[model samples]
Target: MSTLNKVADVVPELLIGAAVDVVVRGSDSFIGDVLGVESRYAQLGWLAAINVVVWIIESASEYAAGVLWRGLAQGIEHDLRVEAYDHAQHLDLGWHETRPQGTTLATLNDDVNQLERLLDVGFPAILQTVLNVVLVGAVFAVASWQLTLYAFLPIPLIVIGSLVFQRRLEPLYDDVRERVADLSGALSANLSGIATIKSFTAEDRERDRIAGFSIAYRQANLTAIRSSAAFVPLVRMAILAGFTCTLLLGGWQTLDGDLELGLYSVLVFMTQRLLWPLTDVAEVLDLYQRGRASTVRILALLAVPVAVPAGTARLDKPVGGRVELRGVRAGYADGPDVLHGIDMVIPAGETHAIVGSTGAGKSSLLRLVLRFDDPRSGEVLLDGTDVRELDWDSLRGSVGYVAQDIYLFSGSIADNIAYGRPDASQADIEAAAEAAAIADFVASLPEGYGTWVGERGVTLSGGQRQRIALARALLRDPALLVLDEATSAVDNETEAAIQSSLRRAGERCTTLVVAHRLSTVRHPHRIWVLDAGRVIEAGTHDELVAQRGSYAALWAVQTGEATA
Candidate 1:
């Protein structure tokens, strides 16, 4: 009904404009008799004035409808694009890892844009056209039913032709959309990997590949365009046929005296005015199908089931971060187990270190503990509670994990450090920086903590990024701290300072370190060695060196007694 009212506002003006032509035709037919009197000429001139006013109203209505529709379309586009991006971020890590960045990019940017085009232009015009058609047809009916019915005889043929083209074009546009995403993905990958492409001297190869993708996209569009291009012309022909029928049938009817002369003028004008614009309905239907296809792809992303349902557990309520691994037998999908039937316990206030070689699954172990990926079997217990059973927010909140591959976001140093906990005070942030041994570097900078790090902290050195990451993790003050080579990139001097901070942190919280560098663990309460996903040995550093096992072998290699 609301839609109907908008149509009512739009249609009357279009009808009036179309009716002006009818009025002119009628006045011309009666001109010989009317012009015979000065008073009749004056009356005819006044009707012409009314027709001019109606034409202006019609133009104004179309302009208003276009403006209103465009504004609404922009709003809708903004909301949908933002919503899709936000939902994509909330999805699980596997989704990002598995999905093509280019495909997702195309869905968010290109597909959303397609919707905007349809809503702004195609949709508004469709409504206005419908209003025009209905109103003009209604006018013809009122003027003379005999002529009105006869004039629209070929309209059904035009409509049928439109539907046939619509059915054929829908699937073609779907193919075009897929090809566009493919081309977008290929282009995005090439751009992002330009350095790799150059290093491997694969630039020519990549260009050829992108050319193939673009050609496919073009071909898909051409296929649809081939069909869509024919439709408007075909529809126009059908309309021409209808107009011819109206000219012949209405002319004959008037000659036979079955129709009044004035109404014949209305029928002649209304036949073309009412049905001719419908030739463009083919183009409009094409836009609609394309928009709908793009929408389905976009909403599919939006509607991906919430993989990780949110939990409301608080960070402050863990049981002193008492950490335990109870028979955790875990592995990746279809892969051999990385952690086998492991049982370990760390009292609430002790520091433990796990040392292993490359692929010793040290990092994988941290991933399991952090609940980034769950253990295939068994549980990671926190304060006698399985971490999985705990709310994700609460579990990760109480556990501060600083990974080996440090990533510092591009932002102010203060913002990067406070990424997790926003309300951390200035002093607290400084203390964290001091503990991580990057305080001097930060203080020496012109902006202090206000310095902006370039993308992924490219502005900072590797060691500086590491320290900043450590500082960021330190601000969390979690119950359990897992630092995987937390001081690996730092200089010896910085290492000592971080050690001092870790020594102090030792008394405050349980620390788990995964390191190959024995120098960092001279004072750890215990050191566990893992090989082939099983713990090979466990003891103090002195005890492990004395035992001459896997741990001693690693210790000897680090101390220069053995290389393997």
Candidate 2:
């Protein structure tokens, strides 16, 4: 349906190109007759009058066509970009993790722009060439069929050459598109990791790496260039052959008195009009191949299945946040299970902590609750309703998640805090910041809440970024709050303060924390000890310490009684 709308948008502009060809060729015939008239001054005046009318119509149509076609291309590009982004946002983390950010950006920006360029230039060029052929060929036939027949001698060769050109250009242009994506990915990665590269003194190494990718991109373009360069000249030769035959045959026929001088002149001009536009046929085909390549990439991305489909159900009211994982088994898209058949339940309005060794799937548990990655073998339920059966917006909005890797967009601190709840008032934003124990630090800044955080909160400390993320999550006033190493960057004193605040906040919300430091989890309502993707023990911190098992062993290590 959208394709039809897009074609409709561009069709008028194309038809105008055909109309312009008629005016151009018709004026040529008029001027040719004026040149032969015995009343030269009178004929010249009439020719001037005809010129003014044709110019007015031609200029108006040409200008409107350019404006209308460009507008159509822009609208399509905008829609495509938004569709790609909206689809990407709904995909599961597993899908996002498998792809490069650069590849996605390249498809959204570069590939979409390529198609736009095709529409802007290529579409009109093709229309003009076709119109010239059809309109001029018909006019030539009427003037003299013999001359028209001679003019078509090179048509078969041009058609065959174009077919061969397209077949060969497809793969070469596809390669060029792939190389462009690689270059985009490499550049994005380097820019994001510039600080790391500088810290490690790997500037030269990174430069060389980027240069290699650049060379590959250039080479791909050159290969396409080599092929395209050969095309226009060959097409021009075919065009020249047709033009020469018409000129010779029509001139001979005119001298032999078989053709009128005025009619012969018109035929000769029409033949030039038909054949010269073929010289640019190569450019039109180049755009076609490049646009075709980009369209394939864009379509491929759109076709990737949404890993987490939004369900049709909505909550009658807000959920009470009772989360239960029933015999849940889970894994990444391409990996073995990270969370085994783990059955657990956290009652509404309770705080629970998950502690495990590195790679013990402590974080994975929180992800399951948030539905970042779904369980493979069992359902994750919230308030007795399977999360998959709930509307994704309602399920996600009811949970406030803060991960170990904090991401704060470039904006004022207040804006970042209010990101999850854009309608939050200044007072509400400040209250959430206070609850997260970040209000004092924010108030100390020169701009207070208005201070810019820079890209990814680079102006602030890691601890500050985490606090801002927490404040953002807190602003939602979610029924369920999930923190995965949320306070890992804060100092011991700040951690203690935040933990105390969290304890008070948990009274109204269900809190789940993946803890690295035992002290942080010790005061939670319940604590679970995970080992090798299995829940080895579940109880209060004191209960597990009494058992003197894995939890106790970890506590001992943290307390300096055993080696980690």
Candidate 3:
């Protein structure tokens, strides 16, 4: 359909070119004799009819070309946007951690959107200009090469001007694209953190921050527009020069009987049509250059390699659910080592707890075992296999993780609980809820498990959100479990309730908990005290307490028996 539609305008251009040749030949003889012979009059009438038909054909083709090109361009734009979004979500947690969410969002939304605007207006203009050039240049060459040479004097100027515009505009457009992305990033960050802005009474401050980016973007666009605006008047002057050359030179040829009057008329009309159309291309090139800049960003985003390749292992069963980290040297891309040459192992069916002060690398430890990121050196092993080598889906499927910040996709209670175990039945969901001690609360809801939790589970209390996240993990029934900061934000009663459930978790899977409050993890079979990225002490909770070291110190501090 698109190719056929593209042919529409081009076909008429050919027809018009051929008709002009025939019309020039006919008009030369009949135009002179007002009382031309009968057969000649008949031919003149037919030529008039042919001219009318060609005009209609040209108009219809142009309309068709506009619709087809614009529609196809939009389709391609939307496809790219959807693909970028899908790929971004599939990327690793490490990628998200390293880059700002606002930047990626800007590429997906604003950058892709810019391409659509360019394609919608710019591509059709290019097509019309190209066809006009071909048809007009052909007519000029056929009439007289000398006259054609004079008419064609501006060809190199148009070409040179477009090339100059392209070079100047390409980088200007790139800067414009970057500025737009910066503005979008700033806007997105402010909007997402609007609550933080309000709480700090930093609304004015954020507004200033956004205004800075907006001004940069506005200035960048103005720079590009300024270049493009100069293009027209300059091209118009060149066009005028070409037209003056044609008028002065062609008039001499006609008067000297060197060229026919009708052919001269065609040359003048064709030259104006050809050169005028090209001037519009300069403006269209501006749009095309901008779109090219925006597309490169989008394409670069798509080109980002998936750092964590898909693994082959799928969790079939974890009989023991043991975990071990051996010679682990871990750090992020820019940071100092968070964990250094750490060796530790958890026996199957044991509930191990980790305690540490701020920036002690406790959470980073779990991330390695979960394969959210690979350790810089050494191995994170689950069930005797390096977690990195295991299929990500399989490794993750076999382990249930509830992070410090409990996350829930917006959905009904049943939907959120079934997040990890999508195939779980209502009975399974209720059972998982019971395990987390939120089943009764679910029953009391106006819609029970069908109750809708707003975005990120905002409708639920902190404790409720934690339990829902817990239930979500429990529903998966993975052989290994990591409860990270499970009891940090909950009340004592809720903590106790969740703790009671943890005591029973050992029957099925080995569980590791990252503990901050002392009471929740007091009875773990093993407790490891981490300080400045090393395991300074590790033993049974009772033994660690006897040592009166870092773990004991943290315990005392949390229990209010000591300061810091």
Best by TM-score: 2
Off by over 4 Å in 3: 1-68, 313-320
Global lDDT of each candidate:
0.79, 0.84, 0.80
Clashing pairs in 3: 311-391
Per-candidate count of clashing residue pairs (backbone under 3 Å): 0, 0, 1
- Per residue, candidate 3 scores C-alpha lDDT tens digits across 1-564 of 323333343344443433454455654454324434335456556556655765676567667767777787789888999999988877778888777777898788878877887888887677656666666677778778887787778878878988888898888988998887778777877776777999999988888888899899999999999998888888888889888888889889989999766667666766777677767867788878878998999999999988767677654454457899999998887778989998999987888988888899999999888877788889888778788778766688788889998888888989999988888999999999998989988899888999999878878898899899999888888788899997777788877888888788766788999987878888888888899999999888778878998878877788788998
The order by descending lDDT is 2, 3, 1
TM-score (all chains, Cα) for each model: 0.85, 0.93, 0.88
Highest-lDDT candidate: 2
RMSD of each: 4.1, 5.1, 3.8
C-alpha lDDT (0 to 100) for residue 515 of candidate 3: 81
TM-score order, best first, reads 2, 3, 1
| Cα shift from native, residue 327, model 3 (Å) | 0.8
By lDDT, the better pick of 2 and 3 is 2
Scanning candidate 3 in windows of ten residues, the lowest lDDT window is 1-10
RMSD of 3: 3.8
Tell me how candidate 3 scores on lDDT. 0.80
List the pairs of residues colliding in candidate 1: none
